[model samples]
Target chain A: MARLLLLACQATANTVENEQKSMQVAAVDTSKVSTDAFLKNRLEIVRVDKKELPDGLLKVQVTARNVRTGFWTQLASWFMGDNPYQIAYRFTWLDIDGMEVETAASTWIPKTVIPGDTVRLNAVSPNPRCKDFTLSIRENDAARG
Target chain B: MNTKIISLIGITSTALLLTACGPSVKRIDATGNEGLVTVDEVDFKDWQIAAEKGINSLLASGVLNRSDGRKSILMISTVKNSTMQHINTRILTDKIRQALLRSGKVLTTTAVGGNGPDDMASKQVRRLEEDDMFNQSTVQKRGTAIAPDMSFSGEIVQQTSSQGRMRESYFFFHMALTDLATGLAVWEDNVEIAKQGKKPLMGW
Candidate 1:
């Protein structure tokens, strides 16, 4: 009986160690965004597409996937840390001259994502001068407070 | 004496530890999502999300730019608050107005409002025309005030439901821009936010 109990203990420890390793791998995968390092290693940009509207306004859509820590890692996080990450993003419009089109309309829109899920966020330019846009995504660490 | 000293030291350490763990407050960014959230109530972040979606949709529709070589004048109309909570509708409209003005395609007229003139100063300054204490040349003349070409109005509605230990709340923000001349709706948009979580330990 004692031997069996010892085996069970060892199995639990191995599960925890494996979970930690997977979390590390997920972190490393998040640092791939070259344009903005802040979002790197946090979110993976899967696709981006833009189109011009009939009124000459620009619309941009971005598909981003959250880095997944394994099931065991998520279980561990539920007990001791933040699990099921939340994030906020906004789009900054740019004119044809590459200068930012200033508009107070843009706000940080919040979204919640479970591990391994992809979320699509889209935005439209406030005026016809907007020819391009850059999306900014950051971890929604506000709830922790 | 040694026992008493040890007891005193222990009490001091315990007191310090408790103080460290006690609740404290700190400032946070207003425009950012750094505020507390309640499961059954609409929070600031929720308002921001709705406003962002509504303004973006309105701008993208390009209805405000339909005016011929001039910025469309907008008048603030009644925004109905149909929610259980006593929420001020200005929280949402103010954000939209700021964004619309920044776009330079629309201008809000302070000379007219659903309640009254948004800027009473327009009328107040006109009264100065008869006062010798004030310069008549600086006073706004009658008929010089521009009429609003369009009116902005909206409604915010909320619904709540509970299943077992979980509670869900949904808020819908609806807005419309009406052309005063044609008496037709020029643009309309709606934004909905839904949140589900464990029931609050305290009051709703």
Candidate 2:
């Protein structure tokens, strides 16, 4: 019975492979993420550089340092020297109208930062109309995530 | 009494094992991060995460931005897969292609390529001129086809190593975009994915 069930699932997966799942994206509100709200990600914000590329696309670079540590995290990372400060970040690109700009690269990306280590999160606007962006960060949920 | 207790423990253990067999199967987000991971072999999640880097970097390269008030035409030259896995290269390029199309900076060519056109219909449709049943005026006029302005190519490679009880696998996705007129690589990017795990004392 287990073998029969597995084959049926395999067949369904093959049929669904060519189809895409629908997704919804919400716009980024400047009112919520106004001045200094980026610090809520638990990482210390160091610097932000923004400029218009030769192609007129907006390019932004965020330099941040890992500064937060808990008792368990320190014990696992400092004492045992096993874990590092791992986090995942996603960029929310926005148009001038404050609407979300959809792009394949907008998905969450994972990163690892050792204590006191500085990292740079760089992004180039996927579309010429992308004029603004907001970043969302959270602790790494799983190994691949 | 001792015999009865051992029998009781054996029956309880058997029931627990059967119940812990886990679900048969389920569906998940193909592009999401909920996919499984392993220290060996490239999985769906690996391909998605790896392709995401290529798309982001390519758009950031500024090579696709045309100054002539026209979208740059792109051709997929060769994406070599030197990995040990029996994988198709399109799994990586298709995502990049879809992203670039959405950006509106570049349009991929389908009329010509190194390995022949991806879609033969453009070339085949032109052959309609030979059929007298069709209107000659409606046939696409000669010299209306556009040539590619740039070529996109890359390679994916894998490396493996083992130390003590830990095993590691590293993959590098290297890509480049070349200007056909100048024959110079205008943009290049390399993305890496590393996986490592320690083996248990027993089991394959």
Candidate 3:
């Protein structure tokens, strides 16, 4: 009986550890982040999908999950105005030759994500020559006030 | 002994006060949200959002494409400011121009504008053709300027309202592309940005 009880306790501890490991895995995928190493820890990019549109423009969609909660409450956020973990993302398009395809559409865009919420961000290349792209994301420091 | 201890405490307090009064400065990324919002005025982020939406929609519409497989010539028209806040309309137009130019589908003409001419130099150089002060051969000849195929113009308007303690402001950026020959609007888009918060201590 003593040995059986000890094994049961160990199984419960192992189950808790596995649950934490899964949560961490769901939080962020390190392999998918091709650029911006700084955001690897701060943000959780769950999925990235790209396709060529009928017009030859390349469309890219990124789904990101926020892993952190608001540091302040609603009333505190309203009064003192805290940065609600806002993110700014920009995409750089590259042609088949690996040269940068400059487009006016490539600008820093700001997005807000509630804690633990998954949000989809999409962008289309301005021209057909853009066959590849690099996405960069960073936390908005100004919003963190 | 007690007086000496009191003096030491006073000096420590003074040092702390001075340190607290020192100037503090921090640098932040311009593209990210620094959490700056004003109830009465439009902000840079607001402009970015508007420009992004307008450019994206314009590109997706393929209105700048020409049937002749040649780059379309574009002219800047009047962008009327109907908002209460003073704003240079170029903040929105320039973004569209830059995007269209980079796409290699459109070229903007400096010889034409709503006010008169985008660059008076194009017209001023013509006078040199008749003047002996300069070489007539090098001067721009008449009918050499390319006419714009399309004209770009827009309007920016704002609306404000309040209910209880919360106030809201909405800015609408409306843009249209008109075909010069047909005198028809080929493409049009509107971007709206709305903000709601408590009433500020100052201007609306």
Candidate 4:
């Protein structure tokens, strides 16, 4: 009788564990990140070597630094993997006379920013017609994956 | 006379014994091994690291997105070998091409490269046949040129310095992706690898 009762208890415990796991899995949401959070992590455009790209392409480098530091909750960082950090940048183009070119090519690119590290992102404009430009940066949380 | 003979025998035996005991002891040159050796030349590991960095930079910069509709087509163009030795530049270029293709943002030439397209001659033959049939059937026959959106070109340069037995080498690899239409480079990267060695020794 005791053995049977123990088996029944084990079965109940297994069912509860599985139900809890399913709940956790169901709670996970693969949603798009927020724009404000994205902007906060982005790079601050310090300076551009040339403001205008004559040939529709501009050669410029953006300087960015990682300013976040703290004891990580996922604490195997010393051996398993590094703390995640990302540099997100976007490029806005313009015509020779200085007008925004709203095209599909304008999108954010995520760059790996090492922890407590500063990086420079260099770019050469590929669009021959793009003359003036604006560059923006945001922090990327996608690097954690 | 007897004493002289005995002396000669004794001297010869002693000389033989001494010669046998001192079997040509040559010193091992340990100046190179005296300390940790650094390689001054670009090695396999260096190439690996540089290639990785270059790919990362290219991906991060979103240079390939410059094509029409944020989609770009790439072709493996000229990769100049500026180094002393004859190296197949394809090894490095191929890796870059593969990575770019896998990134889902860029498309590379699928045509097999012989003097024509496709790795297999049979596939090229089939494609040609299909094109010919299509051309014959169409009222307005037009030839579609498979022009690359961007052409990749680069060079690898190497430098070496030696002092006595110690040696150092540095290799710089520069790469650029230029738009075929405008003759403008859309992406450019430089990777430097340096190594040092005391002397030439063959072991990993």
- Per-residue lDDT tens digits for candidate 2, residues B1-204, read 999999999999999998889666889866455677777788877777777788878877777877788998988888898888887878787778778877888888878776689899888878999999899999887788899988888998999999988999999989888999999999999989998988899994
Off by over 4 Å in 4: A1-145, B1-42, B67-70, B112-123, B126-145, B200-204
Worst 10 contiguous positions by lDDT, candidate 2 chain A: A12-21
TM-score of each: 0.74, 0.77, 0.71, 0.43
Clashes of each: 3, 0, 9, 21
Tens-digit lDDT track for model 1 on A76-127? Answer: 5454223566667777776666677777666678777666788888888887
- Please give, for residues B1-204, the per-residue lDDT of candidate 3 as tens digits: 999999999999999999999998788655445547776567877877788778777777878877778888999898888988888887777777787777667899878898688689999998888799888778889988899999999998899998977878898889999999999999999988777788556865
Please tell me which predicted candidate would have the highest TM-score against the true structure.
2
Off by over 4 Å in 1: A1-44, A53-56, A65-86, A94-102, A112-119, A127-132, A139-145, B1-18, B21-23, B200-204
CAPRI-wise, candidate 4 is incorrect
> lDDT score, residue A63, model 2?
75
- Worst lDDT 10-window in candidate 1 chain B: B31-40
Q: Which stretches of candidate 3 lie over 4 Å from their true place?
A: A1-31, A34-56, A63-87, A97-105, A112-119, A138-145, B1-28, B200-204
In terms of DockQ, the best-performing candidate is: 1
lDDT of 4 by residue, B65-137 (tens): 6525656778777667777776677666777777666555677875533134424443444455455455544
- Model 3 chain B is weakest, by summed lDDT over 10 consecutive residues, at B28-37
> Could you give the candidate ranking by DockQ, starting with the highest?
1, 2, 3, 4
| Candidate 1 global CA lDDT score | 0.72
